[model samples]
Target: MDPHGYEHLTPAEAIAYQNQLRQKINICELTTPIKTIAGADISFDKNSDILYAGIVVFRYPDMQVITTATAISHTSFPYISGLLAFREVPALFNAWNNLYSKPDILVLDGQGIAHERRMGIATHFGLLTGVPTIGSAKSRLYGKYIEPADKLFAESPMYDNNELVGIALRSKPRCKPIYISPGHNINMQQSVDVIKNCIRGYRIPEPTRQAHLLVNKIRIENGDNRTKQMGLFD
Candidate 1:
């Protein structure tokens, strides 16, 4: 992995590489119904080059906060489109390794199956960790959306050159839609249902929303410049 561009792995072996990544995480099946889901997000101080990674765990369906972990690290690589997982996954894992409770499914704040090779940051992370994950991005990475007028779940199908990749869903009535896709060991509809259940009267799900804010919160607390209240949409 060169830590830049899509040159880390070839498109031919990307799927197999992803499968290899998923094999590392111990996918323990729960005897009880799923009760918790977590989200992870990261922010970078472009000036100082410090990375702030945050994780928020919440009770499933109910979306109650359980725990939070945030870690700071140096940037591993410059931001690139396809190879994004390598840049932030290290810091995210740092935060995740410190958690007492592990989540059943991770609601990632990035794209999943909606990628060109079905391996965006969310999918790459899920595949690497073997944790079932979903992408809940604020913008459509690569898709055409109908942009529904009335429903909170105003959905539009995501496509990559005629391939149906994922769904763009508006979890709230007026708020922007979240780009959703199955990351690993999960179907698209289940991903959508799980994300919807995690909503706690906000635009993004509680876990992700909390993690998003917490990422900047830690930066601000540490006197890092990544906490500039810039526009959410980029």
Candidate 2:
């Protein structure tokens, strides 16, 4: 299957494809020591079809910036809530290809198994690239959960029926909780632990928050005049 061939897919076709790939998802604990971690995000203006995808790698445990990659591409897929991977992953794949230093794990700014079909952008990307990924979404895409406590690191289990899907975590005091789920090559508990390590006085974890800022910065700097790709390293 051509991983980038999602552009021409109908909504039904996309759903079918997601169903097909989801069976391959492996949920387990990460066995390797995590020396590096990365975050991925997408940004676009509502009035434009251009998408800015950014990936920021950081030295894990310490959270120092390592390298960043950004890609600008045009997506033809319409905004479908459950099928967002079809619209976003192509550009993110381009950015991933240009990354010089791939991290040990990735924190995607979207859902993982916490989706209706259990095939969110993070899971899709992990299936495509065979990387360990976790979704740290700002909003709950799927699952039912009680509100977490107001203190930092407080969490509540999120469930779809009787199945555990994700967690609603309070990363900062008085802020809304962030949703976390394992994408691939990781488990729910490990996902929460990794996200906890990434938070630093912010509602969103540092990995994904930094990636969001990077993509939006690129979008604002480039404007809507042209589509291009760029990368930065530190």
Candidate 3:
């Protein structure tokens, strides 16, 4: 494999690659207006070989799905903690190539700078694609915090060793909070605000939720060899 390619890296190499790129991740406030947002996700078949990736672009605030792209490919990597980008991002790259319009920001259904390794899928993908990205995950990866209020828009800081890494966000009343983190070219607060704007009465942000549904639909239409929920990254 090329030095930066994910094709043939061992688990150790993958971890090292993440650490190497971690320094390049930029978590800064979004300085411009966003009129479009893209949500991305990937799913795998049994034995973790065949992978499906999807991207859903939506008009900001309105959350209207405007464009969608999907791709399927075989992966050689296994499921490993802190190194999921290797298993998922290649297929996403394929789908990204098919997009007719470029979104202003990408909201992914996985951890971003909130990761234990500081290089989750969203962060890694952002660095690779040169796109601003945010991570809005359904569960915690590495952080601790007091629970945010259950009401919609409630949120609290998530910290790793006293360093604030992300937010535990309540997107809807009575639903479990989802975690939000900056991936690249955007800061934590900006990420939170973007997610809040994309929500449409659902637990997950609308862009990511729509992308999740699209990938699952593709998986089902193609054939589900396994009953497991799809891996969360794009």
Candidate 4:
């Protein structure tokens, strides 16, 4: 599927697509002792002509890095808001395929139920892969919440039309919060707990932080100098 063509999907078509996709996601085929978790994110070249993705897998409790994969593809879609999954999925899944240790859960840098039809990249990928997944993004795509001032687990529930969508979690003191949402096979609180369990030093969790670094590293190694492109916060 051409990411550029996603824009052609009408509002009704988008909703239908989402409904069709929901049929494939069970959201119950999940393991509690998720021994492995993976993180995925994408980056574009400064020229915005190339897309790069990184996937990092980590063992639970111990948090040992087990595997890493990186992939690059010609940018197939223009940078369009609300149509980001189309742009990133092609290359990102390639990276997912390259990994040796399949993770029990996947963390994406997009939303889960924060989109037009309560679907975003994380939800899309979760359904496509049938893996328990969640979205931990840095910004809000929709809904409203009272931003918490405290750090270290300060959070507020995010809502849209009174529907619980996600949570804004502050993992660090005085730092911006990360948006948390269930992608598949998880609940809202579990999403937050999983993210909290994965944190190490940085604002983002270790697996995701490493994945972000690796994507940027790949960009640099491939001569993709997009002003270092500034890593996506999450």
Candidate 5:
């Protein structure tokens, strides 16, 4: 599906689009070995129309940063709780186009199937790009579960009604848990396993953590100036 034109969609239209997109989400085991993985994030100032998107690719297992891409774009979509993909993915798609080294897996700092419509930013991007993606959200948007043990890698199942949606993972001791869910072209178990492997003494996984840092750094470097631009760095 094309990843454009969403900025002009009304809330109702966006929700309907999400429902349509959710039908195409394919959650299954990854068929390819992961040699490279990426983390995606977006940053913007409060009440600002400008969005700074970042995608960081890393060498898998070793988790060394390899490629970084960034994009700046103005969004017209209002900040709706469940419709964030419409507001954010256009700029992220611009950044994705700037990426020189596409990874085997893409981890996003948002919901996946763990959403009200099961169409979070990660899943939306995955369907748009046809890439294996996972959502590693810092908080839960849907579902219920008992908190996991306060230890590294402790995880508990999260369910919506009777259906399994995601996992609540304690990635670090003392830190609040993060939510893990398959975005597209991947399954729940594989999502948790990939996130576990990406953790490196941090509350957030390496790929997404690095991506968060990168986007924030770019936003700071650019200061309050906002413009439409796309940049790639090795």
Candidate 6:
């Protein structure tokens, strides 16, 4: 099944496709003032083909949740190491189409430009929607870095093949740092700063933390008995 013509491709073809899209990534300073930001995440229904995609939009500095969106779909793509965007992003696009208002930037619970392929879920989603996006993951997908200081707002540059690609951000003191990278139309430093402002005494930031809760809420309401995973990036 072709869910936008690329999902059905063979593994080799998918890698090539990722390499092609990688060229389209634009890493530059954000010119637009960020008033609203949306945190995007996806979860799978236990032992089933159903997947849920969620988006939570909130005021930037105020951090007030304004609206939320969710989409359910049967994903035809399988989970792979480098081709994660293909498995997850179609459902996200379904949710994106239902959003009340487009966010100025999207903070996603997955890799951005910092993937082995350089085209992770965050970057793919940003290109598809033409919005600035950032990827904040609980784990590192690629890039090398030393651990940042165990304090709030500490970060270290993450490099892949000797090229700086992202940041390892310590959002809260004594907590494991979250990996952050630019998805589209934003620089690495800007991505780190945006996530830092969204933290609210948790390892995960508010936008994504709220989004994680909302998606789990939707999954639980749908009769899934799985326990909620506790991480901002999950």
- Kindly report which residue pairs in candidate 1 clash with one another: 22-127, 152-172
Could you tell me the TM-score of candidate 2? 0.94
Clashes of each: 2, 0, 1, 0, 0, 0
Candidate 5 or 4, higher lDDT: 5
Task: Tell me how far the alpha carbon of residue 100 in candidate 4 is from the true structure, in angstroms, after superposition.
Answer: 1.9
Candidate 4: global Cα-lDDT?
A: 0.78
C-alpha lDDT of all candidate models, in order: 0.73, 0.92, 0.86, 0.78, 0.91, 0.86
Off by over 4 Å in 2: 225-234
lDDT of 2: 0.92
lDDT of 6 at 38: 92
Q: Better model by lDDT, 1 or 5? A: 5
Residues 1-234, model 6: lDDT tens digits: 234665677889888877877888999999999999999888877666788889999988889988999998887778888788888888888888899899999998888988887887899888878899999999998999999998888889889878988899998888889999999999988898899889899999887888889888898889765445434346
RMSD of each: 5.8, 5.4, 4.8, 5.0, 5.3, 5.0
TM-score of each predicted structure versus truth: 0.81, 0.94, 0.92, 0.87, 0.94, 0.92
Best by lDDT: 2
Worst 10 residues of 1 by lDDT: 23-32
Instruction: Write the residue-wise lDDT of candidate 5 on 100-167 in tens digits.
Output: 86899999999999998889889999999999999999998999999999988898998989989899
Local lDDT at 85 for model 5: 92
lDDT of 3 by residue, 135-158 (tens): 998998889999999888999999
Clashes of 4: 0
List runs of model 4 lying over 4 Å from the truth: 1-16, 23-29, 226-234
The candidates, ranked best first by TM-score, are 2, 5, 6, 3, 4, 1
Clashing pairs in 2: none
Off by over 4 Å in 5: 225-234
Q: 1-234 in candidate 2: lDDT tens per residue? A: 565788999999999999999999999989999999999999998678899999999998999999999999998998899998999999999999999878999999889999998998999999999999999898999999999989889999999999999999999998999999999999999999999999998898999999999999998888654433222221
Question: Model 3 compared with the native: what TM-score?
Answer: 0.92
